[model samples]
Target: MSGRFDRRVMVVTGAAQGIGRRVAELAAAEGARLVLVDIADYVQGVAADLRDQGADVLALQADLEAWEGAESVMARAHERFGRIDILINNVGGTIWAQPYEHYTPAQIQKEIQRSLFPTLWCCRAVLPHMVDQQAGVIVNVSSVATRGLMRVPYGAAKGGVNALTVNLAYEYAGQGIRVNATAPGGTEAPPRLTPRNTEAQSEQAQAWYQRLIDQTNAHSFMHRYGTLDEQAAPILFLASDAASYLTGTVLPVAGGDLG
Candidate 1:
C-alpha cells in the first residue's frame, strides 16, 4: 500500500475535507504530487496542514461548476506538475432534502449546479490534457441516493454522472484514459466546516431530512452509516493502477445498497 502512487500527479477536487481530503491524504502517503481544489478558501488551510506533514501539495480555490474555473484549475495543475495522471472529481452534495414537488425552481437549478455541472465541467476541462498524455484516471464521487430518498434533483444529477462515466470511458479508452465512479451510501463524517445550506431548518424540513436517513439505513445491507475511510478507500482504488482493467463502472460502496 505504501508508495503506490510514487509521485504521480493527481488532482483531487472538493479536497478541503471529508472523502476528498481523506483521498488526498492517503494518496500523499503513497507518494502522489497533489493538486487539491475547492471553492472555499479554507482549502488553503488544508493544504498548509498537509504540507506541515511533509506532502507535496498545491491547493487552489475554484468554482468548478463554471467552465472558466474548471479550465483554470486544470491549466494550473498542468503548469505546476507538467502532466496529470489522476483526477478525483469529489465535489457536489445535496443541499436540500424534500419531496421533489416541494422544491422551488431555483432550488432545482441550484441542485443541478451544485451536484452535476462541477463534475461535467471538470471532466470536459481535463479530457484534452488527459488525451494529450494518452493516460489518466478519473474517479467521480457519485451517490447511492440516486435511488434513495428526498433528493430527487441530486439523484438525477448523479444519474447524469453515471451516464457520463460510461460514455466517457467508451470514448477515451483507446487513448489510455479510464473513467469510473463510486456511489457512496450514508456516510458518517464530521459536520461540515461550511454548511451547504445556511437557512434554519423548519420542522417540516427536519422531518423530510429524517426520512432520507431512514430510507438510507433501511436499504443498506449493513443498516448503518459508513465511516469516511470506508468511502475514501474505494474511490482511491478506482483511481489507482490496481484497478488497471476497470473502467466505466460505478462501484457501490454502500454495505449492500446497490444504488
Candidate 2:
C-alpha cells in the first residue's frame, strides 16, 4: 500500500462509471483511501469491489448538483477520514447534443446543472476543510468539447470549470492547496447502463449527436477517441505528488486538440 497517494484520503465524484470510475480504481490501486461519490446506487458496487481488493474506500450516494448533497458528502468524508487530501471533481456530461436554437430553456438549464453545478458545489463544499488543513489537491474533469461541439450549453459549463480551476489555484496556492483541470478529448468507454439522457431522441437529434462525434474525431490529431486510461492517467498525475510543482494549469488530454 505504499505509493504516491499512500495514506491520502481522496474523494472522486461521478464515481459510478466511465472516467470517474477508472480514476477511482487506479487511485485505489495506487494506495489512495477513497471516498467515491455519485448520484447512482452503482457507486456502492464500485466501492465494494475496491474493498474486496483490500483498499480503504467509502461510497456515498448524493446529488452533487445540490449544495446540500455536496456539503453532506464532504462532511461525511471529513468525519470518517479526518482530512480531505484530494478532490477530483468528475461529475459532468452532455445530456443532449444539438444546435443552440434547438435547446429549450429547461434543456439549457439542465445542461448547466449537469455539467457545471456539481463541480462548483463540490469545490465550495470541500474548500473549507482543504483550506483549514492548508493542503489539498483538486483535479476537475473538463472537456475538449469546450471549443468543438454541438452541445453549446455543455461546452459553456466546462468552460466555467476551467475558469474555476485557474482562479481557485491562484487564490489558494499560498495556502498549499493546488487546483487544476484535465480537458479530455473524445474518449472510448462502455455504454452507460443508465444513459445520461433517458428520453428518446428524434432522428434530427441523433444526427446532431453524430455530428458532435464526427467533429470530435476530426479535430483530434490522433483522429480517434482516447481510451479511459488515457484520460485518467493525467488526472492521477495531477492528484499525486509527482505534480507537486503544478497548479492552476489545465492539461489537455485530447491527442493534441487543445480546447
Candidate 3:
C-alpha cells in the first residue's frame, strides 16, 4: 500500500498461503511486479489474485527442496522479469513432529530439505545476479522458535537459517546486495501451526494442539498473535531502500520477544 517497491521486480517463495501469501500480497500492493513461487498448487491462484488486483505477477510451482527446483524458479524469474531486485525466502518449515530419537535418517534429510535447503538454494541462485547488478535485497523468514523452545531438529534448521542471514548479509555487503532476516514469533495467519496427522491424531493430541495454539496468543508481551500485516512489515522494510544501511541483522517481528 505504501508503494515502497514501485516498479521493482520481486520474488516470494512459499507464497501460496499464510505468512508467505500475506507477504507477497503486501509486496504487490507496494507496487512490486511479483514472481510467486510455491510447491503447492495454490500458487497459481495466489498469483492470479495478484494479477486481478493489477499487480504484474507470475506464479510458478517448483519443489524448492531440490537444487534444480531453485534453479528453475530463478531462471523463470530472469526470463520473465529480466532482473530480480528483491527476494523473500519464506519457504522453510519443519515436517516431522516426533522426538529426536524417533527421527530416522530419511526424516532428518527431509526436514533439512524443506526447512533449510530452500533458503540456501535460493540464496545461492540469486547471488550471482545481485552481484552482477551490484544491487539487491533479500529477506529470509526465520522463526523466533529458533531461539525459544522447540523440537531439536527444527531449532537446529532454523538456527542455520539465522546464521545464513548474517553470513549472506556480510558476504554480499561489499557487493551492494543487502541481506537480512525477519523472525516471526507465532502464527499470524491460517495454516496456523505445523501440519498434523488429523486422521490419526487422538483427542488428547488434538486437545494438546489446541492448548498450544491458545498459548501462542499470549506468548509475547502483546498478548496476541502477530498479524500477517505486522509480520510482513519488517520484511518489507528490509526489502526496501528504508533498510539500505541495514545488513547482517536479524530483525525480530515478535511482539517484544527478542529472544
Candidate 4:
C-alpha cells in the first residue's frame, strides 16, 4: 500500500497462477506498470482482471524455456514501457517427486528444463537491457527444497538459481542493477488448473510426492505450508528500493528452514 513501486516498469514471468500471480497483483496494487508473462492462456485473464482495476498491464504468452521467448518478452517490455525497473523470475516448479536413482535420463532432463532453463534464459535476455539502462532489479524465486526433497533435480536447479543470483548481483553491481533470490518453503494454494505434469502418476509416484510434502513440513519450524502472501512479500521487498543495500543475497522465507 506504500506504493514503493510507483511508476516502475516491472515484469513478472509465470504470471498465470500461484506465486507469480500473487506477485503481479501485489506489484500492480503498489503502483507498478506491469508486463506479465506465462505460457498458459490464463495469463490473459489475469491481465484483464488487473486492467479492470485500472492497472497498466501487458499480458504476454510465451514459452520461456527457449531463449527467443525470453528475448521477446524483454523486447516487448522495453518497447512498451521504455525501460524495465524490475524483473521477477517466477517461472519454475518440480515436475516429479522421486528418488534420484529412480529418475530416467529423459525425466532428469525434463526436470532441469522445467525448473532451470526459464530463469537462465530470462536472466540472460534481461541483462543487456538493464546494463544499458544502468538501473534494474531482478528477484528470482528459488525453493527451500535445495537441501531437503524427493525432487533432487528441482533442488539442483534451485541451487543453480541461488548461485546465479549472487554472481549476477556481483557482476552488475557497478551498473546499478541488483539481483537477489527468495527460497520459499512449501506453500499452500488452490489446486492448479493446469497441473505441472500431465501424465498419469503411478502409486509409487504418489507416495514419493507425499514424501516430498512431509519432508518440507518437517524441515520448516512452522510445521505447515506458507500462504501465498508470505512468499510474495519477501520477493516484493527485494525488488523495492527499500532493499537498496541488499544484493547478492538469497533470503529464505522458509519458516527458519534457511535453505
Of candidate 4, the 10-residue stretch with the lowest lDDT total is: 1-10
Q: Order the candidates by TM-score, highest first — what do you get?
A: 2, 1, 4, 3
Q: Candidate 1: lDDT of 243?
A: 99
Writing each residue's lDDT as its tens digit, candidate 2 over 107-165 gives 99999999999999999999999999999999999998889868899999999999999
Over the stretch 220-241, how does candidate 3's per-residue lDDT look in tens digits?
Answer: 7887778888988888888989
> Which segments of candidate 2 are over 4 A away from where they belong?
none
Candidate 1, run of 10 with poorest lDDT? 1-10
Candidate 2 yields a Cα-based lDDT of: 0.95
* Collision count of model 3: 0
C-alpha-based local distance difference test score of model 4 = 0.93
Candidates' lDDT values, in order? 0.93, 0.95, 0.81, 0.93
Model 2 lowest lDDT segment of ten: 1-10
Q: lDDT, candidate 4, residue 106?
A: 93
239 Cα displacement, candidate 3 (Å)? 0.4
TM-scores of the candidates in the order shown: 0.98, 0.99, 0.90, 0.98
After superposing candidate 1 on the true structure, give the runs of residues whose Cα lies further than 4 Å from its correct spot.
none
